[model samples]
Target: MASENDYINYEMQKRTEPLLGVVIHNDASELNANEWREVLINAPEERYVQGIAHYYIDRNGQWQAIDTENIAWHTANQIGNEQYLGYEVLESLSSTDEEFLLNEQETFRVIASDMIDYNLEPNRDTVKLHLEFSETECPHRSFEIHTNWKTTVDGIPDEWVINDLKDYFISQIKQYMLN
Candidate 1:
């Protein structure tokens, strides 16, 4: 029988790779239910084929977030890009509003629930935090953030790829580097 870690690692790898694009949101706590829903409804339609979302919470409180596989809206007009992942954190760096701590757990639960139906397992490698790929102080600085996000550093392993797959990724990397 496969160990729990092995199963988790396999599931994580499956969720992490084969994605077209990834979308990172700044923060989810500032938006209300309607606003948040609208954002989900008006997501981008460019290269966002598949994506995941992340959120931060202050001390792990209860929170509720929405999940929309198709519909989308933009908070700052950044959701137009298609084929990506999304995340919403429930914490604030500059502001100390207790409301920010509210519904965070629920948001995480809902996000996780959506992942189950997302046809992909929940894995840190596949899902990225806002801070991981961006230079902004987004997702908050005080909030304890999760870091398994696949930034440029945590790239896919060569051993994980077959000969053909390895060659394809290598070529792609070379092309990316050249460009």
Candidate 2:
């Protein structure tokens, strides 16, 4: 009852709306491309959750991208899921800060290239974080590595919000675009 091209069909999860922005997330685990591909296909347990991770940087510091034409069920919100590509940066399994930062930098470079292809600019509107769409701590490692903010009494961040993260990522994307 299913085929490999089932999701590839335009009627399935294809992107209908014009390309808008990008949502950055941290996978929180280290999985290879084949492992990630399997996760993407079988991880759609939640209702209508596509479970697709559109972009990421492998542990080898290589940028990887999935089906960009299809709408990734990444963002919990429909708007983001339909309009933007969700990028997942592989987290450091050994908790190495430098390795994680390097992974993020590779991701940023790929994202910057995608922005150029989509004719998008590095700004608040075009750059987004997973926390903005839902209450998840996605992009967590990225936030922690880039900023000194830690969880507060609310069990979430206080001083640093999505804007701070967005600004930092936007600046990074901009820097990559210059190279």
Candidate 3:
């Protein structure tokens, strides 16, 4: 059987388009290709050496699909993640239960294939995790990746959290400081 890493690489090598960059989150916010497989069954049928940079949601309550183009609030680096594509894996209250979605994994494979088909370069180098960029333990619980997700640099908020704590904090701080 084809391994997950192999599937990911194959998808990446296929993308020929030049893209902004790839954004990864330590939270369950990123989407793996396996979950996407449900939407596009034929993804496995295609052969790709690389994968696409996209976003996804966790299985906490219901599976919500995140937009790849829209910027997220997950800031690992200090800079704003305005140009990078974001991908989030799902996380639950339980660390042991945070299983990687097979569809998300498959979706990742197809995305990599799409990028290769378009002839583009991924955001930066590889996928990134929330904590890798900064000091916060985001993606919460068991949402952390074991590999390349560690590319996050220190003091880089280029990739920030979206519509979550980041926003909440900005709102709360603004309100509290104003009094």
RMSD of each: 15.0, 4.9, 15.5
Superposed model 3: Cα runs more than 4 Å off? 1-19, 28-54, 57-67, 76-80, 95-98, 101-107, 110-114, 121-126, 138-179
Per-candidate TM-scores read 0.39, 0.80, 0.38
Better of 1 and 2 by lDDT: 2
Q: For model 3, how does the per-residue alpha-carbon lDDT over 17-91 read when each residue is reduced to its tens digit?
A: 334444444343333334543443234324211222244433332222334333433453433244445555443
Is candidate 2 or 3 superior in lDDT?
2
Worst 10 residues of 3 by lDDT: 6-15
lDDT of 3: 0.37
Assess each prediction's global lDDT (C-alpha) against the native. 0.35, 0.70, 0.37
| Per-residue lDDT of model 1, residues 6-71, tens digit only | 110011111322333333344534554334334443455331223323222233332222223332
What lDDT tens digits, residue by residue, belong to model 2 across residues 1-179?
A: 11122231222367889988899988867774445545554333462354555765654643233477777778888888889888877754544888777767877888998898999998998888887777777777766667655433234565346678788889999999999
Candidate 2 Cα outliers beyond 4 Å, as residue runs: 1-12, 32-34, 41-50, 59-65, 151-154
Clashing residue pair totals per candidate (backbone < 3 A)? 38, 0, 75
